[model samples]
Each structure stands twice: as structure tokens, then as C-alpha cells.
Target chain A: EAGVAQSPRYKIIEKRQSVAFWCNPISGHATLYWYQQILGQGPKLLIQFQNNGVVDDSQLPKDRFSAERLKGVDSTLKIQPAKLEDSAVYLCASSFGRTGGKETQYFGPGTRLLVL
Target chain B: SQKIEQNSEALNIQEGKTATLTCNYTNYSPAYLQWYRQDPGRGPVFLLLIRENEKEKRKERLKVTFDTTLKQSLFHITASQPADSATYLCALGSDSWGKLQFGAGTQVVVTP
Candidate 1:
């Protein structure tokens, strides 16, 4: 059973530059999620997708951050004109079922981004 | 406003001892609570989940207790090992869709 997979284990960019991340979830998983984890803090949900449709994205920074889950299998999260504070880890997680809040989520290694 | 807090200070424990961590929240009645283990530079891995109605749950050597009255959760790792060293996070889920609010996390270092 393969877990969620992400690309570019680490990234470094200057402030105001653009960065994008990719995520490939586990097979047969219906719910996908993207979270931002700052240093010393737990991961914060940025967006959630259920079968290619966005379930929630209230915490997403609409002005600069955007994500898409096409075909409900793989997803991407992008941040443009990034700020130094955006330096953090971006994690992708997936669950086999959407049984409300009870499903266990499998996480990827995450993409660590650093904005200078 | 809702807030979730974990011990900001790290817990250092010897191997074969029990490691206990706490998670406290305010202004929110979560439907369920979850605990995760996060290694340095890696994403968190799910450990356990306890609903509001459940008082305690266990998996192998890990035990989780939820107290809705106090709005707190306790995570315990029994017979701890050096491999248990990592940051532990507690997340609260308030909605049916599984939206979660996470705490700052507590670092645990188990030395052999």
C-alpha cells in the first residue's frame, strides 16, 4: 500500500517569487487535503477536495494561494508573490473514506518551502 | 474565538518510561479529537481518534483519553522507546466534513 507522494522535498525562493507544489494521493482515496505547517506549529488546513470538488478552503489565502485537484487523483498548490512568512512545510494527506471526521489520514513526506 | 494549546515545553523522558502529553482547547466543542506523530522535516502520521462520547481509546502502546467536560485530551505512550521521539499534535474536528484545528504540538524526547 503506497502512501501519498509529493514532489520536490525542499524548495527555496526569494520573496515575491512564485512557487508551486505537487501531490499524488493514495490509490482509491476519495478525500485529499493540503495543509501548511509553520515551524513549531501543527499543520493548518489550507484546502480540502473530495473527488475533484473543493469541500473547504476557508483558510486559503485567495489573494495569493490557489489549489486544484483535477480528476480527483493528483493535486497541486501554488503560491504567487510569496512572502517570507510563507516559508513552511506544505503537506498533502488523503483518506480512504469521507465518513465525516473519523477517517484516518495518510500523509506524504511534505514539501518544505523557504522564501528568502 | 477558538484556541488549542499544547505544552510548549518539550518533555524529556527515559526509555521504558511512560510519556504523557496534554492538549487543551477553549471556546469549541469538537465532535472528535485526533492525535498525530510528526518527525522532524516530515508530515504528521495519524495515531488515534476519540469521539466526544468516548472517554478513552487505545492502540497498541498508545492510549488517548478525551474529556469533553474539561475540553482536554491526554495522549500517553507506554513503554516508550527512543524511536518515539518526535512532536505530537492534537487536532479538533468540529464539522462532519472533518475540518480540523490543530494545536502548536508538544515535543517528546525519549532517550534510551
Candidate 2:
């Protein structure tokens, strides 16, 4: 089976510019997730979507970061007025069930973003 | 706040030897803990998961031991190979819906 898919494997933008990342989860998967991984660090959860509705976004920087999963199959994460600290790899992951802890998550290749 | 920590240093081991990695957490009572393998320029791949009730789980040559009393998890790779070289991440989750907190990861290098 195909794994999660993401667009624009790499991106570069200047500070204060805006950047967007896209994710298409695995077929039939019910849960989608977005994570940010800074260099030499683990991926940090940004937001989670369970079939078009948000399950959790407590870590999301609501002031500048936003994400949406309109159809429950694909999702997008956007960061406006990017800062140098925002340079990191954006990962998208998916799991089969809504009760997620037990299921294995399939991850995409990730989009590596660099802010100048 | 809950914090997860893995050894930031790299583990260098000779092929055919066993490599062990550790994950420690504080201020978190996780129901389940997971391990993932990440290579350079790539996202992490799920390796194993162990629940609080379970003491040990094994897959192939990999073994994971979870000690809730100590708030620690140990991962062992037996018969290690060069292909096993990668960063290993530890994640903790409390709720059933799977919101997770991750550690920075420990890098392992196996040399032939």
C-alpha cells in the first residue's frame, strides 16, 4: 500500500515571508497529523485531524500557524511571517483508526523548510 | 510540563554486536511508549511500541523493555548491522487518541 504523501520536499523562504506545506495521507486512514522537526530534534506535534475535524492543536502557534483538513483526506499547514526559528522539517503522518495510540503511524517524506 | 529525553550522544558499535539505547521521561505518566527509526533526510519509521502494562516486546532482533517504575525504556538491537545506523526516537502518549510527546532522539552507528 502507498504511504503518506507530501508536496514540495524542500522549501526556502526569507524571514517574514509565508510558506505552506501539503499532505495527503494513506488511503482509508482516519487520522492525520502534522509535526515539526528541528535539526537534531525529534518531531513535535503541531496539529491533529480526525476526519476533517481537529482533535488537538494545543502546540500550534495560533498566532502565525494554521492548518486545515477540509475533506479529511488531504491537509495543509501554513506559517505566515516565518522566522529563522521556524526553519525545520515538516512531517505528515497518518494512522488507520481514530483510537490512535495502538496503531502504527505511516509518515511522509517531509518538507524541509529553510527561512533565511 | 512533561518531558521526554533520549541520549543526545551517538552510539557507535561494531557490526554483529548488540547496541542498546535508553529513553527517560519525567513528569509524564504515559500509557504507552513507542520507538521510531529515522534516517538522514527522511521521516521516522515506526519500530516498536510497548504499553505500561507490558514489560517487554520483541520484534526480530530488536527488543524493547519498559520499566514504568523507573520511568524508562530500553531498546536493544541484537546482531546489529551497518544498515541499522540511524537515529532512534522515543515517544510517549497518555490518551487513547494518540497525542504524543517525543524526545530529541539518539543516533546509533554500526560499523563493519
lDDT of 2 by residue, A1-116 (tens): 88889999999999999999999999999899999999998999999888899999999999999999988899999999899999999999999865646768889999999999
lDDT of 1 at A7: 93
Instruction: Please write out the lDDT profile of model 1 over residues B1-112, one tens digit for every residue.
Output: 9999999999999999999999999999999999999998788899999999999999999999999999899999999999999999999998877777889999999998
True contacts kept of 2: 0.75
Candidate 2: the clashing residue pairs are none
Tens digits of lDDT, candidate 2, B1-112: 7888899999999999999999999999999999999999998999999999999999999999999999999999999999999999999988878777889999999999
| Candidate 1 to native Cα RMSD, angstroms | 1.0
Query: What is the lDDT for A13 in model 2?
Result: 97
* DockQ score of each predicted structure, in the order shown: 0.78, 0.77
Would you give the TM-score of chain B in model 1?
Answer: 0.99
lDDT of 1: 0.93
